[model samples]
Target: MKRIVVLLAFALTSCSYFEKQVPNEQELLQKELKAINWNQVDEYPSIAECEKLTDATQRKQCFFEFLSSTIQQKLDTDTLSVLYPELDTIEVKITVNPDATLVFEPQFPQDSTAYDKKKIDSILRVRLTDLPKINPAIKRGIPVKTQFILPVIIRGE
Candidate 1:
């Protein structure tokens, strides 16, 4: 009986001694990346006007300043006669393509603006066409595309 009990214990212990596979270097790298925030980039894309700044924070600020100024400067407020007094805010999704072209996507509340989508697209395209090529953002030393949602206020005179 003691011999039978010892053999059963050995069999149970041996059956439980399975090995776990260790991940390879590439698999380990991918697993580490899954823990990171992809939204944050090492370097932001810049325009010609923001190229002078050397510090990372300053460069990012300058890029945003230049972008906002460009949008505000190019908007033809005189052509925007369909804005409601209370709801004058229009959200513009600005995407800087890898090749440096600008795309303006306007989002307005249904009751906010009287203008149709086609009219708004036309209005924004004209202003966005003048945007210069942008240096793409960098992630781990590789260039990546970036975008921003800008709120634009249009007031009627």
Candidate 2:
């Protein structure tokens, strides 16, 4: 009975030696965060037409090309080029919000005094308001906002 009691006690104590310590919630979360790459997204933003593409590079290219063409077409209908004949190309900063809203801001050169910036901005706002539905970019399966600068050519004709 004494030997059995000693063996049982030794067995119970030895079990702890093989047991591994589990990391706490905070530690686990920190580890996961470190593993993620914040600079690059898993998927770029897309429209319904570009969504049919399976390749990442192809989809991104399609989205940018479509956006540039759409912006050019919309602005062509307006008097932007006629008002600012000196400006042949304008670099517009496009922001794609996580909620799928778009914001367009025209970037002008430091010495650009020939054009009225406020008037140009207002025209852009009106022309760009009725764009097709956009799907926001995805990072780690979560929707994220993205911004890119697109140079749009102004048709002088």
Give the TM-score of each candidate.
Answer: 0.71, 0.87
lDDT of each: 0.76, 0.93
Candidate 2, position 66, lDDT: 98
Write down the lDDT that model 2 would get.
0.93
Per-residue lDDT of 44-155 in model 2, one digit per residue for the tens? Answer: 9999999999999999999999999999999898898788787889999999999999999999989978889999999999999989999999998899999999999988
Give per-residue CA lDDT, model 1, range 1-157, as digits (tens). 9999999999888876776676899989999999877989888889777788789999999888777767766774546644435445678987866666667899767785456778777888876776777888887887777888888766555
- After TM-score superposition, the amount by which residue 139's alpha carbon in candidate 2 deviates from its true location, in angstroms, is 0.5
Alpha carbon lDDT at 98, candidate 1: 67
TM-score, candidate number 1: 0.71
Which portions of model 1 show Cα errors greater than 4 Å?
1-23, 81-87, 110-113
Which residue runs does candidate 2 get wrong by more than 4 Å? 1-11
The number of residue pairs in model 1 that clash at the backbone is 0
